[model samples]
Target: MLLDKSVNHDEVLLRTLAGRNFYASIQTVVKQKSDGQLLLYGIIEDISERKHAEQVINELNETLMKRAQELESVNKELEAFSYSVSHDLRAPLRALDGFSRILLDEYQDRLDDKAKDRLSRIRKAAQTMSGLIDDLLQLSRITRVELTVKPVNLSQLATDIIVELQKEASEHQVSCIIQDNVTALGDAKLLRIVLVNLLGNAWKFTRNTDQAVIEFGVRSSETESTTIYYVRDNGAGFDMAYADKLFKAFQRLHSANEFPGTGIGLATVYRIILKHSGRIWAQSEIGQGACFYFTLGK
Candidate 1:
């Protein structure tokens, strides 16, 4: 190559006499002398350390990609297994409930009060099991569903859920305050589910309160850039000691008799929040009230 007045730089791999390979950065400068002769000046720098670091970063990226793929595959398999098992378990439960109902309806005259009570208990247990199975299936489906993210009007969702709850129990006197124009970026369907569970829990827990009140609103975080949304209710709250178990499946702080539930609603809500890269937590005191706070990822 002909040498010009301009400087040139290049990176290349070099091998030593002992057959050791390394990377080098070379810079060359060319000039013409007064005697009409060309002079060449060059500098070579060993860049082996930089090249090694780059190679390590590339390898780490590849490993992370592989691990992510494996995890996705395993998650899909687990969801499918859970779905199949839940469906299969429903059959036996249905049969148990049906037979117990038949005995109670047709053979009630021949059976004593004690026997009838046992059969009724059996039927009730079967029905509870069926509810648990349905909740499990819902959780499994939510885990695998694809998220279509967009702007969601959370205020409207909470209002709609409250309306439904009121329709279900018209006799219950409850006051609901929903802030207007509270929005978020998330999957509309999944976010709706979150509101339904939170609002539904609030409605149920406040059933016995003399003056029940539920509020849905948002607040800005001084320490963080994201907005914090919350659902607050003046109803039967739980102890803070068991807050750690709040988001777990089948973990209930209260007895079924006090507040009937499948114990999977919060778990489903937790999973949906995680799917949106968000977090959920609650604060409450016994007989006081409860407030659930959450933030969605950007």
Candidate 2:
């Protein structure tokens, strides 16, 4: 160049004679010599590695976005299926229940003892199926609901649930020990469901025991910032071998006759804990009591 000026070009891509790509920073300067001739200077620096890294990052981000979209589509489809099945089955379930009840009531004289028993069993199965459907809808709805997190007095909530449980089954004589000032930051309604399921399971399991003692408290952890809350009971605890199946949908460790349940409660609890970005686990042995521990948030 024949100018007395300086210019800079940053991170310019250059190609070699062999067709390989490289990145470089270029600068140019012009100077006038005493002989009235102009001199030009240029400097170049390679930045090929940084350019290649940026390209890889861009590609990774694009792939992640596509995968996220695909997952969202799958979730929407599953939610739609859950909702449709729940809504559609309710009508037929009600019809079955109603018809069976009517037959038992109206045809009592015409039907024999075995026929009446069969009708009763049919009605019970229908009711159980209806309960299962309701639980499924609840599990599906929990994901869609907006979470309103605030400082919730979990101690009070536990006491209230115990009160309701006692009122429902006043026949059970069990003692409950709830720790005072036990609070957590979470959605009140969702957290209440968690407690209801856990505490209810405790009460149910302790039914066969001579003395039932249920407790709710927080576990202090020296290494963790979050407090671990737990529900403990002296009842018919489950075997640790089947612990892995505890939180799966419709997985029951006990027979329906021994313990009447839909098996969706723990699965719902698992989903709720996951939504809050927390963890849950249980410790138990056969004939020993079970203790369920969980964290709400990070």
User: How many clashing residue pairs appear in each of the predictions shown?
Assistant: 0, 0
Off by more than 4 A, model 1: 1-73, 220-224
lDDT of 2 by residue, 106-194 (tens): 99999999998998898899999999998888898898888998999999999999999999999999999999999988999999999
Q: Lowest summed lDDT over 10 consecutive residues: which window, candidate 2? A: 1-10
What lDDT does model 2 reach?
Answer: 0.92
- Report the C-alpha displacement of residue 67, candidate 1, in angstroms: 4.7
Candidate 1 has which clashing residue pairs, if any? Answer: none
lDDT of 1 by residue, 98-200 (tens): 9999999999899999999999999999999898888888898897889999999999999889999999999999999999999999999999989999999
Name the best candidate (by TM-score). Answer: 2
Q: Which 10 successive residues of model 1 have the least lDDT summed? A: 1-10
